[model samples]
Target: IKRLLVEVQHVKNMKEKERKRKVEEKKDNRRWIETQREREKLEKIKGINTKKYRKTKKDIERKRKKHTKEEIEKTELERRWNKEKKSEIKKQSDRNK
Candidate 1:
């Protein structure tokens, strides 16, 4: 009877150890899941920031192109005005002579 009681106690101890191991495993899994969720959230935020950066870069490029176009138009208009003034001055000098 004493030997039987010892065997029963050993079995109970083994079951307790197994239960503790399963509980620890569950905790580890929960921690891993939380970490994965955080990592995905950070990745999503990074993606959004990257998209915003690209949009800002494109806007700056568009503005630069528009400014250059306006500058070219302004210079062309000045050139035409100068040419008209020169022609008018020449015509007046010829009439005077």
Candidate 2:
């Protein structure tokens, strides 16, 4: 039946969304852990380290944090885009009916 097929597809979509949510959460947790580790490294660089070494470490940490933040932003944007596309498709289908 068309209705049954629609229900099955909806279930699949829900499952996929749940999976994506879990993956996004994992990425966020990873970003948090990396940020914490970077901060800890920066703190540790405060004592008995050469000024040059400290500067280099700080720069690397800054770049890494920036990279991770950008990646998270990108993922969120893609998710939003996909959500909008699905909504648009649903609207079009309704209009067709």
Candidate 3:
């Protein structure tokens, strides 16, 4: 049971790391998208709507893809709950022993 809790902890760590990485990636993407949109707006005001501008707009849209905050929080909770459950099981098993 101790070993099981160890495994659960490892899984939780892996999931949290993934969540953090994804959050960082989403933030980077948002920044890039906002920057691109700002540059495009500036170019449009300057009367320079080129193909590159269109491409950048499309790229901005692609960057808009992201997981909801609720989803991220749910996954994080699951990670914690699973680890806690393992610990609980260990306690029960020890009590039985």
Candidate 4:
């Protein structure tokens, strides 16, 4: 009878240990799921930030192209004015001679 009691107590202890291990496993699974959710959220935010960065880069490039076009136009006008002035000076000198 005493041996039977010892065996029964041993079985109970084994079941209790199994139950504790299962509980710890469940807690670990919950923590893993939470971390995965956080990682996904951060990835989504990063995607949005990259899109905004690309848009700003395109805007800056467009502005730079417009500025270069304006500079070209101004230089063209100055060159034409200089040519007209030179021709007028040549004509006046020929008349004086």
Candidate 5:
């Protein structure tokens, strides 16, 4: 009878251990699911605002330089025009002699 009791107690202990293991596995799965949901939400929001995001300083400076190229070209053209006008006036004064 003592042997039978011991066998039964051993079986019960194994079952309790299996139950605890299953519970831990369920908790791990739930945590994994929660983390996946959070990441999905973050990705969705990031996607929505991707174009509106601020650039790093380096990126901002690079873009600034890119946009200024045309403006610099325009200013150079204006400077050349003013220089030509002044030369034309000097030539007119010389011809008046």
Candidate 6:
């Protein structure tokens, strides 16, 4: 009878050890998955931020080019008008003479 009791106790101890090992393995797997998710989220945010910065920079460059073009055209028109006015004055003076 004592021999039978000893055998039963040994079997119970083995079962308890196996259960503890399985619980530890499950906890490790869950922690790894959580860390992986956080890393992916940070990378996505970084990519979006970079794209917005590039688009804003391009828009500023386009605006500067348009302003420069308008200024150049206005100066050209003023120079042409001045030349025409000078020629007209000379012609009038010659006719009066």
Higher-scoring candidate on TM-score, 1 or 3? 1
For each candidate, the alpha-carbon lDDT, in order, equals 0.91, 0.92, 0.88, 0.90, 0.85, 0.86
Clashes of each: 0, 0, 0, 0, 0, 0
User: What is the C-alpha local distance difference test score of candidate 6?
Assistant: 0.86
Write model 3 residue lDDT over 1-97, tens digit each, in one string.
9999999999999999999999999999999999999987889778586987778767766666444566788899999999999999999999999
Tens-digit lDDT track of model 5 for 35-89: 9888767866665444333344457789899889978999999999999999999
TM-score to true structure, per model: 0.48, 0.47, 0.47, 0.48, 0.47, 0.44
Backbone clash tally (model 1): 0
lDDT of 4 by residue, 1-97 (tens): 9999999999999999999999999999999999988876786667555565668768889999999999999999999999999999999999999
Best by lDDT: 2
Superposed model 2: Cα runs more than 4 Å off: 47-97
- Give the least accurate 10-residue stretch of model 6, judged by summed lDDT: 43-52
Q: Report RMSD for candidate 3.
A: 33.1
Give the per-residue Cα lDDT of candidate 1 at 77: 100
For model 2, give the 10-residue run with minimal summed lDDT.
43-52
Which regions in candidate 3 have their CA more than 4 angstroms from the true location? 49-97
Q: After superposition, how far is residue 75 of candidate 5 from its true place, in Å?
A: 43
Question: Per-residue lDDT for 9-95 in model 1, tens only?
Answer: 999999999999999999999999999888767866675565656787688899999999999999999999999999999999999
